[model samples]
Target: MAEIKILGAGPVKRGVTQIAAQFEQGTGHRVNVEFTGAPTVRERVLAGEAVDVAVVPQSAMEEFVAQGRVSADTRVTLGRSRMGLALRKGAAAPDLTTVAAFKQAVAAADAVVVNVASSGNYVVKLLEKQGFSADKAVKQPDTVKVMDHVASSAQNLLGAGQLPEIRELVDKGVAIALAGPLPDELQSITAYDAAVTTASANAAAAAEFAAYLELPAARAAMAATGID
Candidate 1:
């Protein structure tokens, strides 16, 4: 019935794509979702990019609302996920049962690659707390690049990314396997929140979709992507 454009974070590729299709089918709304890095999502919105809705890290919602980039009241949590460990194909999975084992695995790794996003942020803290050298972690701009570096490298490497993104990468043959979710206490969770943009031309439709994100059906669709 209406058309809306959504700017979504890279980690949200799976969840957003899945839900958008269902929303379009159920509502007869033409939904177009563009996936990019989290930083780009913020940059585009802050720079006045025309969009109906956007899904980004919940941590950015306050900033967007404060900047008048998106309607504060339209914000809703779509999905959530925590960091996941990845290792080169056939590499031994780390023993995440204890912090000591995790640290030892890190020390033994020929190289450690991490995306400079939510996943990496949590990993840096975990490494610091365990007294592991953060310098050992090679930071990539995003998860795609992190997986590329790990998969292509001949060295035995360890990488980190969002749980869903890591699994996505594994399917692409980028990372050999997912190593872990880390200790529950040490894992960092990121909430994927969606909001209608202030610049939307189709405010009503955008708001409708934003609200639909909280519906049980939509929430389940998002979770099916392993992001929730």
Candidate 2:
């Protein structure tokens, strides 16, 4: 069994985990998953972390490929994400029907949990696009801490060792909204790419696993988690 590494965001994390579990159960290959913030994952990859495949927001993928850390040809679109609001388990969900409504809701919040580095960038840009450029927002160094703030009652789980789960925040009691979907006009389509690491011990098997991520079984797994 070849070791596979994944770097992804929250929504896709569940899909990846499900796919990995299924793959291992069916093919006898053990898959190890690590979930963390996207920026941390990107930094680690840039810093020379050994990764078999990386699942990141599309916004970050191009930059990574440009830096030679990811293979341009192996990239694949994982799914889409929209900044939706999350309230603690029993908290009332915010109304985000319009940009103005969204702003009002955000302005009325006690504390906002946002990731300034990765996921937060998109939210900030969305806010700016809506003409809300105030710099005083609940800023966190990374998504993990932001998620913690979003829902401390619920444990945060990291996917692909870099991505976070939205449910984690909803479970805790954080309201989430986005400026837009993750990638500018794409409704937050975070594409995940898999490539055999340069130092992989089983490059062939790793490639196969990477290819498997695009198969129906993998797509089904992704769909199960609200990603398509």
Q: Give the winner by lDDT.
A: 1
Model 2 C-alpha lDDT per residue in residues 1-228, reported as the tens digit of each score: 666776554557677888888888878877878777767777877775777777777767777777877666666776664444443444555555665666676666654556665556656666566565555346777655665565553422111112225654444455432222222231333445444445345556666677788898788777666665
The reply for model 2, stretches above 4 Å from the true place, is: 128-136, 142-144, 151-164, 168-189
Writing each residue's lDDT as its tens digit, candidate 1 over 83-112 gives 778887877788876767777888888767
Q: Candidate 2 has what TM-score? A: 0.76
- List where candidate 1 sits over 4 angstroms from the true fold: none
lDDT of 1 at 76: 91
Question: Where is model 2 poorest over a 10-residue stretch in terms of lDDT?
Answer: 155-164
Q: What TM-score would you give candidate 1 relative to the actual structure?
A: 0.93
Estimate TM-scores for all models. Answer: 0.93, 0.76
Q: How displaced is residue 210 in candidate 2, in Å?
A: 1.0
Worst 10 residues of 1 by lDDT: 115-124
